[model samples]
Target chain A: MSDNTGTKVKGQSCRLPRKRFYRARAHSNPLSDSHFPIPICPAEFDYSHHYPYFFPSGGEDHKNGSASPRKVRFADIGCGFGGLLVSLSRLFPDTLMLGMELRDKVTEYVKERILALRASNPGQYENISVVRTNSMKYLPNYFGKAQLSKMFFLFPDPHFKEKNHRRRVISLQLLDEYAYALELGGIIYTMTDVEELGDWMRSCLEDHPLFEAVSEEELEADPVVKLLTSATEEGQKVARNGGQTFRAIFRRIKFEEE
Target chain B: MEETAEFVSNAGEDSASVAAVTMDVDNGLIEDDKSKDAEVAPALIAVHPFEKSVAVAVGFELRLFDLEGNCSVSLVDDSGGPSHSDAIRAIKFGANGRLFASAGDDKLVKIWATNPWHCIRTVSAEKRVSAVAISHNGHYVAFADKFGLVWLIGLEGDNAKQSNNDKKAVMILGHYCSIITRLEFSPDDRFIASADRDFKIRVTVFPKQSLKGAHEIQSFCLGHTDFVSCLAFAYPSGCANGYLLSGSGDSTVRLWDFISGVLLATCEVGAKVGSLEPNGTEDAQSPISDLCASSDGSIIAVALQYSNRVALLSCDFSNGNLSVAKVVTLEENYFPTSLGSSSLSKCLWMVMGASNLPMPGSAQLPTRLRIISGLRKDPSDYHCHDPIILEDNEVPGGQKLLSELQGSLDVTKEEAALAAAAAAVKASMRNMMIKKEYTLERREMRKKNRNDRKIK
Candidate 1:
């Protein structure tokens, strides 16, 4: 678990963090009010702090319209250990991506991981960042309506009890909020090793009126679909254990007017 | 707090079984050994648009009293469907008094015709219903579930025929994972406002075709420190747009310019009503349970969970300011659970009763109905005299109204029991609305023991 991807930066060694030291529990309750400061709305979010390289003049000057502000179009929900974000950052170099994790220590680890990578490979990994937030309650706070182009729900916590069904991240009710945040034709990518949770997620997506399953031909042509099982820590663990994974990719669609 | 600390400490030694047992107790999954028959349901009340009738839902029974006829109105359902099998959480009347909607734990939304008191449509929802509202135009009915989704159903012209087939409800919007507590249509019917347990009030534009989905969010009213419990709109004379009023579990009532999403004023009803205990424990904090605005939009009556007094606030629409005007104290040991006010009436109706009595062997609890008359729109005239608590005989339907709505209960003999019921309701409300905090190890254990994992 020690990362050897270190490089010399300003005569100092910027070393990657060890995964063992940043180990956290597998799940965190999304309903609890975690101790973290959340932006009231998307306008109030300080993008300069998360992506300082993108906003060279800082966040306040970007509102002056000297340059059109760039928004984060991709979100990785429950992005465990920031593996998927790191992979996606390289794949989509021009696109901005954000990883939302509930665990504080994991978020800190991802921050260090990104910083270390940026130091090792200069001018790269600048478009990806991580934040500690309960996305279930605050998705609308950070992303405006139709602001996102893609959403990833990789290896989500499967709240299995009948009473805890409402807590699942990929529920019909929650899809409405996701649908509101995502632009038309925006894709929602979900993957899980647990078969029941995978079925549940697929069924909820199928049942929602605003979402339509991505065609097999489109999924095969998409580069991100291939990395669903190999880009994240959870997916890597499942791969190592020789466990099969299930995926449900859906596109946000507009309803026909009656 | 101490219990959470103890559980965290114990989790280090033996995590799995201990955490599971603790969660079961915390969630009330383990049945109580003491009183199996004790049920604690909150009594809800709704008033008709023209002050023609008042409907009260307690447990599984729906009771209505016709003010003009001075008689009980029996519901006519040719389908012969059973009444509400569980506690009804919300009851509301349409703007023109043509339709009445009621839904609750049973997940059935029943739309009734007001004139004939017949159940025209019964729609079964996927989850327990929390709040419901009929559009001002009386063409649409919307209900919100505990899972934070709002569903809409369009009504056809005057169909009193009973149909047992479940009508499809269109899903319009949602509040993420939070429970939606209140749904209200703006006075002009241009927007619909939904309040959730996450302290958010979203105002979405009512689209021309709502069945397609409400996509445009006009604004978000977000200042509450706790869950929002109720919402109302007050439109002053000569004003085209109405101001929005919201009450929250944070013990405050706030007035907002919803069109622009600006918080105008906040009145600390908790401080005005005073705490039940002087020590100021968490239990002493009074959360507003229900609130209603007067016909002229001048007076707002607020009811706190554990307090025996209803605090009235005066609204100044010119400057958008709210201030506590008066406090009407009720009889000892009685706390108001719900409050109702009609557009055509000058009286504020209040009900004090619990649906399920927590006391053993007390299966039948008596509900008490009270009314306060002489509520005026002019601030000067409203302040000139104290609010008059009308006697039972002075009520619109008099003794007949009391008997029809209250079910001929003897309130004097159940004073002690009523006090206990109030305490139980307060505790249950806290448990239901407050978010529970858990340690990392306990969360892991709970996930490990998930049934989905076991099934695999």
Candidate 2:
């Protein structure tokens, strides 16, 4: 990995970041509000700042009214090291994805990693970015109602205590907010190596009225399902140790009147 | 090979049960430890529309005093269910005075018939209840849980039949993962406003078919810099639309046009109450605990957390402005935990108490009730006479009402204890409402000592 450091190609010099320098603790207290500035609402969120390629500066397209505004459709909550975002960027090159990380250094590392990838490959990796934020507290401030098509909770912190269950990323109550932000037929993907945490996430999804479990046939057909355990840093670490993983993928649905 | 060995050791250590000695060192290490066990529920007060009855919920106990009947009405519950097994967090009366709702940490939302004071229906919640509100038409009772989900139950069916079968509550809306502190239905019942600990007030359109869900959000009133603790709707005498009033831990009371989500006016209530210290530490800003608007929507009563006075503000709907009009100071060092006022009366009722106060030697915690009259609807009558703190004899129901609701009339001896209780209540409120900041090392240590990760 060090061999690629400061590599120059076609008048551009970019290098991949080493994992050892970007290590961060696994857990962050979502209740703490002392983090990055959050937009007051989804409308106030500057898409141009996050995705300059899609939303060009100077409001040229906005003035001409020729193109509809592009919005982020995919979110990876607690995207540690942003390994999944990096992997998913090529698979869906046109889709815009955001990784929300609470740790300052980890978010900075992801930002640098994305910038390096964009510089090295040009035109690619433009659809993915990372922001330092407490997603649990500021999800609505970034995403509007029915704005997202997919969400990923990959190997999130297992707040094990009964009192700390509310801190869990995937919860019955939080699913309501996720459901609000997700478009109809949107999918939420969650995976964990801990069996207890996996069961908890699955049960919460099962008990929620707005969510239904994605069938095995559908899961087997979806490409994102395979990436759940292969793309993220935590997933790779767990795989290296030969650890078993459990996944729960559910779709946001509105119940038909009975 | 060294990194692999470290990974294996970490996996092995996490799977093994942590020893008691190691666990003891991590316990109570977080800054939240001081207020962890001091979860004394603040006293909540609700008044009937006609000023004929007043209800107070301190701990698990609910006390109701009837002004017309001149007696304390006993609650009759034939459901044989346990009544309010935990601290009561919210109590509210319906618009018509026929229904009263009380919910708390017990996870039970009880609806009562006001005349008989009977538990008409008790709906079980999925989590601890935080806020409760009854629709203006008295058809639905909405309660928000600490987990941020709001549930609604229909009250149109037979009371007995509904009580016999555990009626299922329909999920209406939610405020993400934040604790919802207050819920208020717009005067027309067309909208339901919910305030959370995350400094957001969402005004959702109450659908005609609410069982489907409150999906159409009207607007989000989003200027509060801290947790919004209270919400009230004010309808100007001749205005067609009602204005939304909110109080927050940021020490400000704001008025909003809920229909359009426009912030009309903000009053720096902390400065008005004279509670902000010169140094201006974060703790110096006293959070507004409770607020209520008069029937005519001209006067507003705001209760600050650590202040011994209630600041009254006058709302001028003509220009959509709010300004502090009067600061009524209590005779004793009484910090009100809740405030209530009747629509038909010009009196403001305040309660100073908590669920389980940390008094040195007291076995029973006593509540102190005070009443102030002369809150006029006419702005011209503002300076006619200062609002009078009614003597015990002049208060409605007199000393009898005080003893019935407050538990004891002898408050002189427990003055110091009440002051201490106020401080304790303030500390717990700050712990629950204010987000705590931690250093990088502390965050790492907390993650390292997580019981879930350590004990598998």
Candidate 3:
């Protein structure tokens, strides 16, 4: 398998090489055609193109017994280098998780990484994938209302200067789109080495009506929270430097009226 | 180190001084590599009534610091500390600073005694809260949530009501289908103005006689192209009537005369500020993040999203005209996320947030709170200081760490470690199951093919 890197592979999915992954700025969202050649609509987006394997999107039954109206319940926003996704892929073998990233190169790298993993382990890594999209703008386009169950903002890029705070994925306005996409009781997990960014996420989510801050006790009980601090490359980098990872988990909650 | 200082007023000039964060990349003034380690920025801030102490709310913790002593106020056994489970969105001190009210995503509104900082009453709402506002007298605490429903609960009555039965919160359908960002009661308390994400501001009469009348629309401040995030009232003419100023996602700030329901003036901060931006043509939308106007309404400060500068507008409500006083640029894309004004000589507090825009060598920079003092007829000085970083663990002194959060919560590091190990084991087992099932299926398919060939 190691010698087959340059050779043509046949698995329905195209064999993406490790070197093909390059960094390109996120084609700013709503793809106004000026930045991107074509504007994107959620309806026109074909999931089959990204996932070479057949996924039963409530339309057909699968060869394997796992075939209920299954959708990508887990989403990783700004998934830098796809470290967390690859880690979680084996954990939940059946759960479909999509990593939405801004940088084209990072997204390509994640897709290729997923392909390589799938090649090595047959029937595994099929549920994980990546897409290049700026969550700040096109989150609603990718995710439908109340469609997502879990969203991970792991080691997010903290806009250091105050001016770029809006560019930070977790603003009050963007939180609205997040809440819209997340189902009630859906948990949003955020881990950051930067305490300020952690505080910003906590404050924004706590201020919004859709999310409830899951206490550390509650966060610890869950298996997903465990992956936040150590699963990602950024998290690993922070650990190497002896820095603190402020892990905040918020659950999407609403009253009976909502 | 003062760069170019611009003043709409003395206080405005002083506010610019705190941190002195102005655009200096083009001027080659900033060293480009000074701030490392991201700092905790202020989400909401309240200056105590005594004027000696100010309460700055960052994330979920609310820390009260004595300005004179330059130290945080240590509460009784962390009783006066942050109690809400989520972020503290709204924190406001009552007139004279005796009482402070707060509400957040915890769906609870807590009013605390400012002296020792005791949590006197906690009012629970049905939904996660967005904005909280206390009346002029500080009796009724009104809060809004994601649904744009405003609920008011009385602080004093809450004590007795909790003893018997929880008093039903008075709900008002303030803004339609929009998340109400800012809710404020007028100085006279005649009307309460609410702004929402749908780009509309509604001035409704306060529920004086009946709760039903609380939603009575007095006038609508129309003409904002984007969602209004912050609202403030200013008495520019020094008259009883005031003008409402709103900052919005459209990167514009508009002043509206609530009584007449007229659009007074629009100050487009993004256009001028974009010129100073390095990559303005990269096609990112800039929104107006936060704003605050002085009591006199003489100076209005607007923080535009993605721009390193805060635009200060000097407006006169008398003639419905606004002029851009100066666009004070911050140092190297450092944006102010929150701003507060104290009446004592009209000082302005600016909370700085750094852009995480993948620069060459950008590390997590620390949060800085800059206070511009002497806005009135006094000496101007901008003081930029580090904010109080609230630790997650240090709640109290006595109890066992795990026991304090015993009932529904258990947050010990050991427990988390155990849970993590278990999870890793479970994940590996699941992966093995998938592999086993795949191999078995292939074997079964081969057996079927062999049998069919024999029948043939």
The best candidate by lDDT is 2
Task: Give the CAPRI class of candidate 2.
Answer: incorrect
Write the residue-wise lDDT of candidate 3 on A54-114 in tens digits: 4546544364455444567899998877888888888987777889886667776777777
lDDT of 1 by residue, A144-239 (tens): 778899999999988776756666899876777788789999999999998999999999899777889999999989999988888888888999
**What is candidate 2's CA lDDT for residue B416?**
75
- Rank by lDDT, highest first: 2, 1, 3
* Residue-by-residue lDDT tens digits, candidate 3, B370-437: 55543443224334321222222432211231121121123232333222222222222122111111
Q: Estimate each model's TM-score.
A: 0.78, 0.78, 0.46
**Per-residue lDDT tens digits of candidate 1, residues B1-456?**
333344344422222222221232232222341232323567888899789999988777899988878789998865344568888889999988999999998998888988978987888898888899999888889999876789998885432222436557888888765678999998778899999878789988888777667855667787787889999988888877788999999999998988877788988889877756323353436899999986457778999887778888988877877888898887765687899988865888988777677665545556788998877645567456678889887888888888777767456666766676677666666666666555677566755544445544
With candidate 1 superimposed using the best TM-score fit, by how many Å does residue B302's alpha carbon deviate from the native? 1.5
Q: Which runs of model 3 end up more than 4 angstroms from their true locations? A: A1-258, B1-42, B76-82, B156-165, B210-213, B237-240, B275-285, B353-366, B377-456
Report the Cα lDDT for residue A215, model 1.
98
Q: Give the TM-score of candidate 2.
A: 0.78
Best-performing candidate as measured by DockQ: 1
Candidate 2 reference-contact recovery: 0.18
How do all the candidates rank in terms of DockQ, highest first? 1, 2, 3
